[model samples]
Target: MKKLGLILSFAAALLFIACKTNPFTGKQTLALVSNSQIFPMSFQQYNQFLSENKVVKGTAEADMVKRVGQRIAIAAEKYLNANGYQGYLEGYQWDYNLVQDDQVNAWCMPGGKIVVYTGLLPVAQTEAGIAAVMGHEVAHALANHGQQRMSAGMLQQIGAVAGNVIIDDPRTLNAFNQAYGIGTTVGVMLPFSRGHETEADQIGLYLMAIAGYNPDEAANLWLRMKANSGGQEPPEFLSTHPATDSRIANIRKMAPAAKAEAAKFGVTSFK
Candidate 1:
């Protein structure tokens, strides 16, 4: 009982104090770790990764990546400022790089370090397409998805430990552990990850539109991605990402609204 009380109390304290407001969604999000701690580490790892990888430079494709990233960053700042959250990106040292890798992947670290793989270029195909991809990546950073993931993971681990402490019987404890793993993973963690993906997609669509890239291109880019995948994907519930068709459909549905929002910023034309 004492151990359980301590665990619950700790969790309650975290729930109260270890949260930050998401600027985009205006929702309280777990922030067990602060960006002040996450950023320097992310920046260091980014520099290390760049040192070991072939970072493309002085190329048209590389330039396009940087250009699109800058536009997305600016769009994010504009949105935050207009929503009365100015200076939210003060410590963000935005950097974008194209790496010579054949993986169709891109990511943005906590403090705006971004990488786009060369393999993604074929799928992207145009500046608007790149904007679609970069905008999504940048949204991940702007929304602090990484921090949320880490904080949720910490809570998951704490739950597991609390279970171990409270369950005395060996066989029953073992069963509890197995059931807890599957239940938490499928019912909680996977859904949480999928939600982040969807949120990033929506935020990216608006950012791309505001940056003068056709929000409709986001849907088009996903169509190409779907083709590139050749229909090989796990069940949507079992996967970390939304199914391709569903994602494309969602983007299509959101495109018009994204464009309307962009119009508020005097972005009447899209590339």
Candidate 2:
């Protein structure tokens, strides 16, 4: 039994080593879950969410969500194709909906399912603002941030398992599991979320530009976001997004470059 356990551990370690590559950053990442498995589960959950939620019908806001989502999706495709990632979206089933919620939040699930809450409409005061939010959400999907997060969790789990193997005392193992689980959730996951937020910001800038929305508006939109939220947020270390000041500064720095990128696709301004 011990020999079999040793063989299993060795195989698991080998699998971990084989799956290490950051899809967006192009750095070595520790990923134990494969997208082939993750995508199906995400799609299932997204469909369930749609079924459970009150999806807004043919309203102007809903229409706008679909239109903007399509444009951003196209922009992602064009960008990826131009960069030699021709079939990057092959398995993606893109769907966008406006949910009649008062929460100032929006998110894109893996495999391109998106939901925008009605409460955000005021903050997204214009078509450009909607594009900004949608682009940012879609960027999270395109960048596979969800997958990376799940992968990171799996790595943390593997670490916990290794710790259990090393520690013989049952009490020690239980304590280690509890501590590791909490640490992974609060420490590793929170930072991973912040990284996702930053990546989405960068990619969203370029996507909105390519979709012909003014990249400059992104900063203003975030400013509005800050105002709408009443400036309430956790400390920078605990939050999943950068503080408003940092976000505004980063967006300002990236806007010009995003505009330049849009120009490459012959998009100077929106219709």
Candidate 3:
């Protein structure tokens, strides 16, 4: 009971004190781990990854990756400033790199380190398509999804610890472990990840539009992505992303609104 009490108190304290406001949504999100701690680690890991990988440089495709990433970063700043959240990105050291990898993936780590795999470029097809993909990845960083995920992971660990402390019977504890693992992952973690993906999709559309890329192309990009997958995907609830069809439909529906938001920034034309 005493150990359980301590665990509960620690978690409650984290819940109360470890939160940061999401600039785009104005919602308080988990931040049990601060950016000051996460950024340096992420930066180090990014540098290490670059050293081990074949980083593409001096090519038009590499140039386009850097170009689109810079525009999206600028768009993020513009939105933040216009919304009275000036200096929200103070610690971010934005870096974008193209890597010679065959995997179709792109990601932005905490503090704005971005990498676009070569395999993604063929699917991206155009500058706007790259913008769409980069915009979404950047949104994940902007919204501090990494920080939130770490915090949630810590909470899950705490839950497991608490269970171990409270349950003494071996067989009963085994059952508890199984149930807790499945319950927390499928019920909580998966949905949490999907929600982050959806939020990134919305925020990315707005940022791409403000960067003078056609928001409509985001949906088209996803269509290409879907085709590239040969139509094989896990069920939506079991996956970290929305179903491709659902994502395409959502992007199509949000494009008009994204364009309207971009108009506020004098970006009336999109390429």
Candidate 4:
């Protein structure tokens, strides 16, 4: 048991050393699972999802999702390249699809696999509004939030195992697993998800602006989302995103700066 504990400690230390700085936030982040591993899995899962789901075809909304996705992807590439992170998206197989689902949700998997549900279209009333949502999702992928979450889960698992081994009691082991599971799932994962949402909001605003969309529309888009959700939300700390009020306020604060950034790219307006 002592030797096992030593092995686990060594592994955890190795994971700690594997941290990398996130480009968008410039924060050191754990990433025990590499993109090389995560991206291919994401691509396969995306392909499977498309094959099994009702993917929109030959429709205006479908086209809009693809268009917005491409624009955001281009903006991401430009941003990374300009920041001396060239080829950051080289292995990314960017694909966007509009699914015929009523849930107002959108997500971007690692390696740029994105899905925008049809229910979100009405809320994202215009191209720019759709761009706001798409940019946010893309930012989550680029920031590697998924990888960080996975790494954190692994560490939690290691800790739980060590605790069980040291306690040497089945009841104690069960309690340890249950506690660790909830702590990692609800406490850690939820907050991490919320952080990703906030980061995405910030990065998405800039991306939409660089792609020639008025960043101000981002706040409006959230307003629409809030209305769509019927104003019911989990507490800010427990939820995967900031309260709608907070998000709108943040977007309002950032809009002028985003526009200034767009001006550098010769974009004066979105009209």
Per-residue CA lDDT of model 3 for 150-182, tens digit only, reads 999999999999999999999999999999999
Candidate 3 TM-score, true structure as reference: 0.98
C-alpha lDDT (0 to 100) for residue 266 of candidate 2: 95
lDDT score, candidate 2, position 102: 94
User: How well does candidate 4 score on lDDT at residue 264?
Assistant: 73
Model 3: how far residue 206 lies from native, Å: 0.9
Q: What is the C-alpha local distance difference test score of each model?
A: 0.93, 0.83, 0.96, 0.86
lDDT of 2 by residue, 1-271 (tens): 5754775677578566746443345666545566677789988998898889899989999999899999999999888887777887888899999998999888988788899999999888988998999999988877777777776766676677677767889998999899988888778788788877888898999899999999889899999989888998889887877888899999999999899989999998763
Find the 10 residues in a row with the least total lDDT in model 2. 18-27
Candidate 1 clash pair list? none
The alpha-carbon deviation from the true structure for residue 176 of candidate 3, after best TM-score superposition, in angstroms, is 0.3
Write model 1 residue lDDT over 92-158, tens digit each, in one string.
9999999999999889999999999999999999999999998998888989999999999999999
Instruction: Supply the global lDDT for candidate 4.
Output: 0.86
The lDDT, on a scale of 0 to 1, for candidate 2 is: 0.83
lDDT of 3 at 52: 100
TM-score for all models, in order of appearance: 0.98, 0.88, 0.98, 0.92
Model 2: how far residue 187 lies from native, Å: 4.3
